[model samples]
Target chain A: MSAERQERIEARIAQLNAEMQKREDYQAIIRLQRAYGFYIDKGYWREASDLFTEDATYEQGVDGVFIGRERIHQVIVKLSGGNPGPGLPFGQLYERFQLQPVITVSDDGQSAFGRWHELAMLGQYGEHAEWGEGVYENRYRKEGGVWKISALHYFPNFVAPYEGGWAVLKPVEGDWRSPELADFPPDAPPTVNYKPFPDQFTVPFHYPHPVTGKAVA
Target chain B: MSEHLLDALEAHLDSIELRIARQASHEAIERLQRSYCYFIDKGLWTAASDLFADDATGEWGQSGVYRGKERIRSYLALRGPEGLGQGELNTHITCQAIITVADDNMSAKARWRSDNMHCTDGTGSWSEGTYENIYVNDGGVWKIASMHYYVTLICDYDKGWIAGDIPMDPPSETLPPDAPPTEVYESLPGAYLPAYHYPNPVTGEQPKKPDLPELPESGEDTLADAVAALSTRVERLEDQRACEKLQRSYGFYVDKAMWNDVSDLFVDDSTLEIGGRGVFLGKKRVLEYMGIGLGPTGPQREQVINHQQFQGIVTVAEDGKTARGRWRAFVIGGSSWAPVNWGDCLYENHYKKVDGVWVMDKLHAPFTMYTLYTDGWHKATTPNTRPESFPPPPDLAPTVVYLTYPNYYCEPFHYPNPVTGKEAPPPNPAAGGVANMADFASEES
Candidate 1:
């Protein structure tokens, strides 16, 4: 073999190794945040989408089953009620986060499987009851030279009773619920009655909201 | 390429693969007990030794060290009649192991739990502690070359709690009286028992066994529950790691002055034979060795013996009534003059599943070499006598128990409880208390 050809092959191997390492690191960070319910409450749609791939699969309801990144986007659309970003205050979302024990990385360092736990209150589920409290077992993959979440499986550790009605709401007058107050229209003064998806809109995985009895997207 | 060079390359690659296999084996060993502590507590040594390398090394106490498969076999022969035969004392547990696999897979570090505590009597005295370990892949098989344990705590039975020795205290104060007599917690050795032997079915009338408690039936099946159940199995595996920890605790006392408890860790008729030393039989004789080795004159005098680091490779039987375990013990014993090395000796032990619980059936401290200094005079033989006399002068004790007890997670089987007509739970934890929030908080704190 020619010396130049050998050198080129070596360089490609080095590049691929570096890429794999970087992807692994990136995926670990995303997993850490996702398991803690950080993105769910913050409602970071695009960023959350970036964490996963265009064809990523997801499931975070009573059923513990979901597939396809597009479906995840649709679920988020319902979460945001057509809003572009996560609506909850950053403090409220990131407040309760705890990493799980035994985070396992693959031998080749290209993939990882891990679990994490979190605790939080979900007004979206019902009348301001603590909802986000559970562990998540996740699988990640390297895609297009970047690590993206390939699958996220979620379930609550324990469910607590809630009081307030659960339905995505647009903050109205005197409500300190949402930090993005400027985004609301003056004429339709953000009302709790605003339905994100049309009433007839039927989304899959209809886990009943802890409070409102409405399907959780 | 020269054949020699090829051989060297192949050896290196083999070493790497072996290391990885060792790491996985170590992880499995660590989880053996917790996954089947119930089996271990019942004294199943034959099943327990399956976790060990064929040519495992170990020792009984500090006095004898055995090497090679032949010696291990000899040691096992001596385990019976040593009070570790079957259905003797209940094994205790406390474990935590950290395993790291090398990229090449030739060697690995298994930072394991050493907590092996036991209860000879059905009360609260617990002889507990920790161990240390180093696992190497020897010819594609992970074998423990060195293991040791540091004994932290040893609690003997309190005679006052017996039905007659002293009146049972009534629940009075929220916090009990402060500063009770030190004598209450003082270490006094010797068998304290009512001799509640199991029904021999020949001579004496056996006590009627109580009705077996019903287990919660498997609930409705759901995918989520199935996944949760998977985690539960993993949790069980994690708990199995505690078996080595429990052995370590037992080692501490055995290394020190509690030979009976160490013997109790095995089946009643167990035998032990370390190289150089002749064989010892029954729990009583094993205790005699403990009394001498860990006695005042042993070289490790003034040094507390306990399991500070430990690991186990255990396999459960298909019937769930038998198993065998091979483990390593890293001792942390010795005083200023002779401090115990943190990493030492690999203990090859055997276990059994009598009834439903796990217990040590045979223990072989096959290959233990010591590195410690101390004050007492080194004596080839002592006046303290054979097997029963432990706590020998610091100078008399060997540096390590070359072949330790109950090889990796080998499980054993036992006769069914006539009353329940099923396996019985091993004795309760020596540290009496329900496993609950309070215990968790105390452990965390």
Candidate 2:
């Protein structure tokens, strides 16, 4: 091959490597998020919180944002009734289905953004059963070659009795943000003031519409 | 540069190219699996069957295993007629696809979850299941080789699984399936654990078999060979990303009723089929079909059309000019005057690159079920046989009669038994003999 051709080939290889890295980065970040779901479902609070970066931020419903891995761990443990161990007792269960994901990896491959729908069914064996729906807009950072949650913001759309459904009962608000568990207050209130079902609100999109290239507000 | 340095450079380039090709394969396989849901949702049996290899085998629910492309085609056709009928709704929304590609790039396995909602004949139900599917690269085109779906739960919409009133099994009233249940598993209210296709991605140990393929030896590879290989790898990756974006764009456009924009996403000779509305051939007819749903003017102020696409698995052809995709759509739509409705659907669509831009070649959506939100799927189960008044009337009739939940019916599979490679066995005389009522009681106790 000519010298010029060889140089061109070298440049092309560099580009290919970069593209491959980006794709792998996206996959890693998604798997990381999924792993978090698995851990949380079983109330493995420490393991779930460990998936986050040291400086990660965690927020849910109206709960004030909790900064750093420690704070996240604290909040999760408290929510699990202080027993953040793996596997719930015989009568207790918490199953969460993390569905409907739209993930976008940044061009540089250092970070990524994702949107997901959460459908959770949780309760004790003989006690009341609860059904919940929420949306998560999260960010992940590639730290030391491993993906970690940099920020996790969950917006609760509805949490209601499994019997009456979201239609009849009002979802309890501001309970997720228990001040006692937080290291400090959240940076701000809910990003969007949207009530639960019957009343509808479109969550803001972080990326442009796939085809139109128009922002989805 | 020294000859030694040149050789080193050439070797590095080859490695990069190999990595790119491997990554591209992963993306393609994921999309191909997702596209299956999209096709089956709208009763596009032919389109759905086309995704499988000629020798593929499949088993879904209690449906007997089907072997070969022709058998798969015939089986799929049994779900419904050529088009969806009035008031019928079938939605199969798949998620959590754990795909593991083989080192040889010839075969792979994936596990997915399907959350389903069905409404027909004045009744509705909710069902959840899992899929352990395998894929193969045949002539550079990836196709499903074996697909097995194990339904985990089937419940009445109104009662919900928590109520514990609804029976897990539908009355054994339907005709015997091609085979008996592969494993006697009961839905929720029963204790059944369908087997996993692969070991856990984390914590669980990897299986010993199916070792990764060996890397290519760089010693004899020339600089020219490296360049050619890298070029192809780069192109495949680009094609994979573009196809995914194209499929996602379709969902966004239709959600807001961007009729013209949605129509433009298709090729001039492309076709569109929604539910049982029949096939709309060509760009003009496709746009007209959209008009029938959204009014010629586009989305009206009172309309709320949210069609969320999820669990996309796309496969770009090795040639890089054509691709196939599978997706699941969760639809919620209504207007001020109309009653609110919600449903789910599956899409097995195809695309081709035209002038370097990916466009829809064929779009098929077969719904699992659609129902009135007020009455819930349980009480208002409505068959989507043929709408009383629908625009661009279907040019075709449904292929068969199959009701959604509370009434058991299995959609045909595209592949056969994964392990035996044999066609699903015929229903045993004792099959469905005694409803496994014990399985249901096991959960409560």
Which candidate leads the pack in DockQ? 2
Worst 10 residues of 1 chain A by lDDT: A194-203
TM-score, predicted candidate 1 vs. hidden true structure: 0.28
Candidate 1 falls in which docking quality class? Answer: incorrect
lDDT of 2 by residue, B150-182 (tens): 765565656544342243443123433445556
Query: Tens digits of per-residue lDDT for model 2 on A75-137?
Result: 776665454343343334454556655567887788888876676655543455555666678
Which portions of model 2 show Cα errors greater than 4 Å?
A84-90, A171-188, B1-93, B96-113, B116-155, B160-445
**Model 2 clashing-pair count:** 62
Report each candidate's C-alpha RMSD, comma-separated, in the order given: 26.6, 21.9
Candidate 2 reaches a DockQ of 0.03
